[model samples]
Each structure stands twice: as structure tokens, then as C-alpha cells.
Target: MTKIKICGLMTIEDIDAVNQAKPDFAGFIFAGGRHHIDLDQAIKLREHLDPRIISVGVFVDAPIEEILKAVNSGAISIVQLHGNESEEVVDYLHDKNIKVIQVFNPTDEKFNTGADYTMLDSDSGEILDWKNLLIIPDILAGSINSANVDKAIKIVKPKIIDVSRGVETNGKKDINKIRQIVNEVHNS
Candidate 1:
């Protein structure tokens, strides 16, 4: 089965809604953005989540110390790097026994570097050049929704699929859209 990850979760309500939706992974953005959450709020949200669901921390060029602090607080499992972090950073996180997911635009050649996983996002909601990603493994396409997720899956055949803005309607996640995207991915 293709793994589904719902990113950019912000509030307790969002957490509850996503928990009800039952995605394989729920992401918390600790970096500054519309979806950013504080450490305390992430801990509070993590407390309410079921053990079967994985909680991920999203960071963008944050200090390794700060990332470690979030990991220690409530982000016990995965960390997704959405900025220009070095392979050394990934190695350090790996040494600490934390799963690292590196994010990149399709044109970035560094995606092939060592990391537990690599995600490709359509740099401005535009579809990526899938032909350039033939040999990459354990890749997940971001900015995916029910509309283009099937195309991404068919072209990339990624082991995982991640959606954030695509699943949202008016700044809130749509459960039916999440279900639709997941279903289409599986069926494809």
C-alpha cells in the first residue's frame, strides 16, 4: 500500500480532524509559516494522537539544536527538512536515531544525497518534471491533491505521497479530499 502523509497540521482541532481521517502520518510544522506550531502545542497535539499514527516535525534550516529540542519534546519519530540543510545534518540526525526526510524541488540534484527519504514538491503548485526522477528511491511528492496526485503517483511511483495545501480548502483540511487522494493513490 502507498503511504499517505498529511502535512502542515497546525491546531488541536486540525490534529483531531486528521486523527479521525486516520492518515499514516501527521506532520507538524515547527518552522515559521502559516502552519507553524510551537513546541508546547506540538507536545499537546502529540499527546492526543494514537500510537499507530506517526508524528513528524517539519523544519526549514533550523539549528540542529533546536530540531533536537523539538524531537525531544514530542516529535519522537520523523523530521522533514524543507530547506538547504547539508548531508552532515542528516547524518547527525541519523546518529541520534531519528528518521530524516529531505525535501527538494524537482530541479535540485542534491535530492539523491543520503537521507532516509526524499520528497519532491511542485515548486509553485506546478507539476514537476517526473522524467528527471527516474532512479531516486523512497521519494514522496508534495503539493499533491486528488486532482494531480494520480499523475504524480503514475509518473513517479513513489513509495510515499505527501499533501498539504492540496488537501486544504479555505485554510482547513478537507477530510473527503484526503480520503479521495488516498483512495486514488491506492487504486492507481
Candidate 2:
């Protein structure tokens, strides 16, 4: 089955909606940026989530110490490195029994060999080449919506699919849209 992951969740409401949707993974951004969430907030959200759903912490080029802090805080079971982190970092985390996901911007080509999963996203919500990723077991992101999701999935057949801005309407996530995307992924 193609797992679905919803990223950049920022509120209790968002968490509630995502939980209702029952995606395989719910991502919380912990790195310093617009989508960032503090440890306390993430911990509170984590506590409310069903254990069946995996909690993922999104980070970008953070030091191992900082990543460890997130793990210890109960913010995440999986770590997603969205910046220029090294393979050694992925290896070290895996050694500690932490699953590591590596994110690749559409233009990056140096694939890290040790990551548990690889995710492809556009810098902006623009579409990118899905064909180039056909061989990789990855998560497809960037401008993915109910309309184009089937096409992307048919071409890439990723192990998982992720969406953030694509599932939102009027700057907020729409439950109907989330359902549509999830349904389309499963049906396709």
C-alpha cells in the first residue's frame, strides 16, 4: 500500500483533522522556519495522537545533539532531514534505532545511500519531473492535489506520498481535500 503523510501541521485543530484522516504518518516541523513547532507543543500533540500513527519530526541541517533532543522530548519517532545533512548523520541516527528520512529538493542529485526513506519536494509548490524518480522508493510532494495526485502516483509509484500546501485551500487544510487526496492515492 502507498502510505500517506501530511506535513507541516501547526495546530491542535490540524492535528485533529489529520488524526481523523488516519494517515500513516503525521509530520511536525521542529527546525527553525515558518512551519517550526516547539518541543512542548510537539509533545502535547504527540501525546494526543494514536500510537498506530507514526510521529515524524522534520528538521533541516540540525546537529545530532538537537535531533537527539527532539527524540528524547517525545516529539518524534522518525527524523526527516530536509537540509544538507551528511550520510554519517543518517547512519548515526539509525544506529540509535531512529528511522531517518532524507528529503531531496527537485534539483539535488547526490542521493544518500543510508536513509530509510527519501522524499522529493519542490522548493515551491510547483510540479517537477516525476519520471526521474521512477526508480526510487520515495515520497512524492510539491503541488500534489487530488487532481494531479493520481498521475504522479501512476508514474512514480512512490512508497508514500506527502502533501502540505496542496491539501490547503484559503491557507488552511481542507478536510475534504485531504480525504480526496488520500482516496485518490489509494484508488490509484
Candidate 3:
């Protein structure tokens, strides 16, 4: 079955919702976007997260020190790189035994290629041409929701289905949306 990740979680309420929904992974955007949460807040949120579900820290052009701090704090178990992180950086993180997910645009040639996982996105929230791409078991992200999730799974067949805005209502995580999306992907 395809795994689900509800990304960009901000509040304790979001954590509680994810606990109920029980998605495979929950994301915390620490790169200071609209869903950005501070280290202290992330620590608090981690206390309430379901232990079975993995916690991922979404980063873009951030320092390794900060990423290490989050990982060491037990708030984040994985790091998803959404910036122009070099293979060296990936190696550095991997050398420390930290799991990494490298984000790609599908057209970007400069990639870390050594990531445990790769997230493919158009940044426009539409599913990319999976046929044009090679390799399976990659994570598909951007603009994924309940409506198109089934199609994405059957067509794209991504190892993991990732969503953030698609599971939100008025810029916050919605439990119903999260559950619906997960069910749709799983059923597909």
C-alpha cells in the first residue's frame, strides 16, 4: 500500500489530528514558510505525536547544525531536503546516520542521488509526468489531495504520497481531509 505523509503541520491541534489520522509521516516545515514552526514548538508538538508515525523536518537551504539539533532533540526522525543541497551534504548527514529525503523538480539534474528517498514535485501542486520519469519507489508531492490522490496512486504509483496544502482548510491541518486523503490513497 502507498504510504501517506501530511506535511507542514504547525499547531498542537495539528499533531493531535495526525495522531488520530495515523498517517505514516507528519512534516514540520522548519525552513520558515507559512507552516514554519520553531524548535521549541516542535519539541512540544513531538510530545503528543503518535510514536508509530515518523516525524519529518522539512528544510530548504538550512544549516546542518540546526538540522542536527532537531534530530538530536528527538523531535524529528527524518529530514527532507527541498533546497539545492549537494551530495556532500547528503553524505554528511548520512554519515551521521540521519535518514534523508532529497526533493527534486523532475528536471533538476543537480541532485544528491544518494538519498534514502526522493520527493518529486513540480512546486505547482500538480502531479508530474510519471511516465517521463524513471525509477519507482519515489515520493510524489505537491498539491496532492483527496480528489486526485487516487489517480496519483494508480498512475504515478509512488512509494509515498505526500501532501501539505491539500489536507488544510484555511491554512491549518484538517483531520477529515487527512483521513480522507489517506483512505483514498490506501484504497487505490
| Candidate number of the best TM-score | 3
lDDT tens readout by residue for model 2, 40-153: 889998888767889999998888998999898887999999899998999999999999999888667677868999888887768977887533657888788888888888
Q: After superposition, how far is residue 84 of candidate 3 from its true place, in Å?
A: 0.4
lDDT of 1 by residue, 104-163 (tens): 876675563678887777658766677676445465665567887777777778888888
**Number of the top candidate by lDDT?**
3
**lDDT, residue 120, model 1:** 74
What tens digits encode model 3's per-residue C-alpha lDDT throughout 1-188? 88998888888889888898888998888998688899998888888999998999999989999999999999999999999888888999999999999998867766567999988888776767766765454899867788888877887788899999999888878889988887787777
- Judged by lDDT relative to the true structure, which candidate is superior, 1 or 2? 2
At residue 35, candidate 3 shows an lDDT of 88
User: In candidate 2, what residue range of length 10 has the lowest lDDT sum?
Assistant: 128-137
**Model 2 regions lying over 4 Å from their true place:** 133-137
Clashes of 2: 0
What local lDDT score does residue 140 receive in model 3, on the 0 to 100 scale? 91
Clashes of 3: 0
- How does residue 164 of candidate 1 score in lDDT? 86
